[model samples]
Target chain A: MKDQKIVIIDYDAGNIQSVKYALERLGITPIVSKEEEVIRNADKVIFPGVGEAAWAMNSLRKNGLDLLIPQLTQPVLGICLGMQLMCESSEESNTKGLGIFPLEVKRFTNERKVPHMGWNQLEKLNGALFKGVVAMEFAYFVHSYYVPVSEDTLASCNYILDFSASLQKNNFYACQFHPEKSGAVGVQILKNFINL
Target chain B: MLSKRIIPCLDVKDGRTVKGVNFVDLRDAGDAVELAAYYAEQGADELVFLDITATHEKRKTLVELVQKVAKELNIPFTVGGGISTPEDVGVLLNAGADKVSINSSAVRNPNLISELASRFGSQCVVVAVDARFAAGKWEVYLNGGRLATGIDLFDWILEAERLGAGEILFTSMNHDGTKNGFANETLAKLSEMVNIPIIASGGAGNREHFADTFIEGKADAALAASVFHFKEIEIPSLKNYLKSKNIPVRI
Candidate 1:
């Protein structure tokens, strides 16, 4: 349980170093790699991204990660755009995702702010990803697109409306928020992922 | 519901915290990273590091400081002060700064805003505008509020949003040093005119000032420096006070 081989997929996306820093805070120096074998051999894989959808997908495809991510069987965690890319499709750039989770991402309507940037609490928490997390704990979020509440929603947050804050299906877990930048609540989620 | 953010502003000079912080637990009080970690532990929603160094080595020092802050702190932080080009923003963001705030640079070359938004998503671009009420109207100021650009506050914010600025940080020079309250009237007007989030800065002396900003000013976030750094208002207690006012804050 202590020596889990964790690797964070690095595909030239924004803020990948912050993910490495977050894992280092957990006392695990995660390997940042785009190599197929290095990612395949890891006990836990973390896929993180912060950029436009179609552009990010292009980077993933360039590194052959678009095809390899869906085949992984490890306890994988995806953050922000990484999670969106795992879905069936995204309204952003009208791009198709990797289809790991049967969901879709859409742009936030003008009813509220576009980036939904700030701290928001998680509701209806479930699964090991939320272990030891208090009810309605706040986590940092910064994004314009969101995954609507659906079948795989492990946790939900309300902004313009109820959206999927986190999704879980089999070993694949994804969050629309930046767990690395979410302070303690985020740290707990990462620890839970490592422990699982 | 998305809670209103409480951000603390830290002034950095020569890779160190310039404004004196009052946290007793810190071993080295001058270190920017230590102070940033302290603020995070105390429940600060987010942090803004304003670099005050004005030398050629400023970038290298600021980048190292940003790297340290990201590695040590878990909460999101924005790096400001003297950011002008896409290269500057790219270096800071790559070093782990969540967002970069541009001021005079954007005013000088308006195209920079569109360039930054296209290169690194609008979510990470924050345009900080310093303004004051003069001649019966709000005029934008530049170079730390030393020079007035004669740019209308309302018009500038509208232009910034259209150019894809995710958030607007407005500091009322009139209310800044006064510490009486925020520029609620102007803030409310700016918030209404723009679709992006408005972060109200200047004149935060008490907890009620924060609540007022959220209510009357209609700001999405309130930022303060001396109040949090000088320890006049602790983040946890301030958050509790805001929560009591039914201002929807994360405690």
Candidate 2:
């Protein structure tokens, strides 16, 4: 996987540099681009985001990526907002998602806090994403909305309630947390994704 | 459960760490990137660098430092001090900073908060407020607690949140250098009033102080300067103590 061609979607959702740096530290220099052909031909695809859904979706559609992403057959990993956009729909702006997964993204009820921001323990670990990661391992998460747990859920975390911490269906995998900033456990997760 | 964050703040001047750190193993303790990576390995959940660069050209030095640190460090970090406009914030974020904390600039012009939030989402905008108790109320201060403002702390924070501040970094001027403990009473009040996470800064002497702030004050995170710099309270031991006290923290 070290020699694999990795491409990160240059989706204008803010903070794509962190993903590039994270991968660089692992000895892989991923190509950051918005060109459809370059992304479609990569060995691995990294979808990274950090802002509003409606605005990001507009940016995706502008580059004609809204039609190209769901068709990606290679191993694809979506992070934070990237993960949310891969769902059926989101409540952030009532935006329709790519529908790779049937789960619907909903907002937190304010029973505790709006954005469940901080390090939270991962539970019920499953699939290749949790390959070397243990149960109750901490991962950095900063999101206001989440997808409900389903058969595709690889792991779950409790914040206000049980939510899908990570999801996988075929070659598509998504995580609500930021693995790029989650320390060693995060580094291992990235390694697992590349090795997949 | 969300783990309580333990952040070590570095006072940087001209893109270098100002306060003396007691790490004998460090070749250059003043190097901001080195100190940031050291803390990240010490189990610090996050790091906040307060740059006190006075000149305009020297601020670019901070961006370069942030880029180097971001390349090497794995955990999240926030950069602050003298950030006035969105252009300033955009440069820092583009350099790989997770968030930017604005205090005096945000106070002078409230719309800056809304503008930054709208431009970069509320998650990257942190409103840092410095205050001290005076005249039967907590009064907001400017210029590192040197000048006093007629504004009340509670009123200003609520307004900042209304204007779209993601998190509040409240530093109690009275307890900052005292080395006694955090202002738990006021912090608890802040948690009760706001729906967002509150970061308690200043007045941290020992490991117990961190525990007290998280339990009694109900803070989402506790930040300290001298204690961590001088090795008075090592982060690894502090996190162990916190765990023993039943406080959730990432080990």
Candidate 3:
């Protein structure tokens, strides 16, 4: 299991180093690559992103990763902007996403705050990614746009409104928070993803 | 809802923890990595490491220290001091710092803020302002509070936000190490001035001080050094006190 190949999709999105470090701590050496063949053949693929939607999408298209992501049969975990990119589209700069989840990402319009940055509780866990995870467990989040609660949502968190904190559909899984920066509970989530 | 954050600041000099008043008369506290791990266990929302003497050689040591702490701790960590260019920020972030704070550089060349924000998302950039109440107004200070820039605090922070600073770390030079309380009056005003989260630093003496900073100061997070370094206030007890006062904490 330790020798299994895990690939982290690197389309020039931020936070890749932290994800690499997190996997290293878990005793797994993840390959950070932009090659389609490497990502396609890996045991599991981690799509981690942090940056503007348009720019990230542009990079993905440039590297031809936008096409390669949806074709992977292995378990794929998207974090933050990576999760948003999995949706149909985002309100941020009117950018279109990868359309894997068939959900639209919208910006928080309420008067609370823009970024909604901090620790928030994840309730109603309902997928393998959250196995051994208790309800109402806190996870670190930092994002302005969020995917609304939908049938595909595996977990939900409330900031200005209830939003999809984690989504699951078929072999694809995504979390709208930084598990790498989230601490102990986050480590468990990553471990579950590894096992899956 | 996001809980109010309690951040313990560690000032590092020559790879060792140091505590000082008004940014002078530094004294050794302990090893930086050891203290950082202790803070993570104590439920500190986050930890800040400032390389006080960010000399050419010390900068390399700081990067190694950041890697050490990042490997051991599970919580978020921020690194600052003498970060001037995007490459410098890249080095620290690549070393595993969750965020990088820019002080003198941002003030010297305001464009540095946008440069960093563009390369690494705005969430990765923290603009730290060391301000002092001088001549009937708050003025921004640079070089570890040794020089005054004649820049208005409110005006500069507004520009920082416009230029893409994710958060503002406002440290009141006058209230630092006083153990009396925070500069709530100014902090509250600053919080109102910007939509971004403001981290109030300096002058945290007791548990109530944390409450006052959160409630009165309206700061999203409160940062302190001496109080935590001297064990004058324990992180767990301080968080418990804040929780009792109806202030949400991580616990």
Per-model TM-score, in order, reads 0.98, 0.99, 0.95
CA lDDT, candidate 1, residue B71: 92
DockQ of 2: 0.86
Question: Could you give candidate 1's per-residue lDDT for residues A1-196 as a string of tens digits?
Answer: 5588999999988888899998998889788899999999999999999889999999999999999999999989999999999999999999999999988799999898778989999999999999999879988888888899998999999988999999999989999888898888898999999999
Candidate 2 vs candidate 3: which has greater TM-score? 2
Candidate 1 Cα outliers beyond 4 Å, as residue runs: B20-25
Tens-digit lDDT track of model 1 for B69-168: 9999899899999999999999999999999999999999988999999889898899999998977988999999999888998888899999989899
Q: What's the true lDDT of residue B101 in model 3?
A: 96
Pairwise TM-score winner, candidates 1 and 3: 1
Ranking 1 against 3 by DockQ, winner: 1
Per-candidate Cα lDDT values, in order, are 0.91, 0.93, 0.89
Q: What 10-residue stretch in candidate 3 chain B is worst by lDDT?
A: B20-29
Candidate 2 residue B19 C-alpha distance from true site, Å: 1.6
lDDT of 2 by residue, A1-196 (tens): 7899999999778888888999999999899999999999999999999989988999999999999999999999999999999999999999998899998999999899667988999999998888999999999999999999999999999999999999999999999999999999999999999999
Instruction: Give the CAPRI rating of model 2.
Output: high
Regions of model 3 farther than 4 Å from truth: B20-29
Give the clashing pairs for model 2.
Answer: none
Sorted by TM-score (best first), the order is 2, 1, 3
Grade the docking of candidate 3: medium
Assess chain B of each prediction and give its TM-score: 0.98, 0.98, 0.95
In model 3, what is the error at residue A21, expressed in angstroms? 1.5
- lDDT string for model 3 (B53-172, tens) is 756876888888888888777788899998999999988888888899999999999999999888888888899999999779999999999999999999999999999998999999
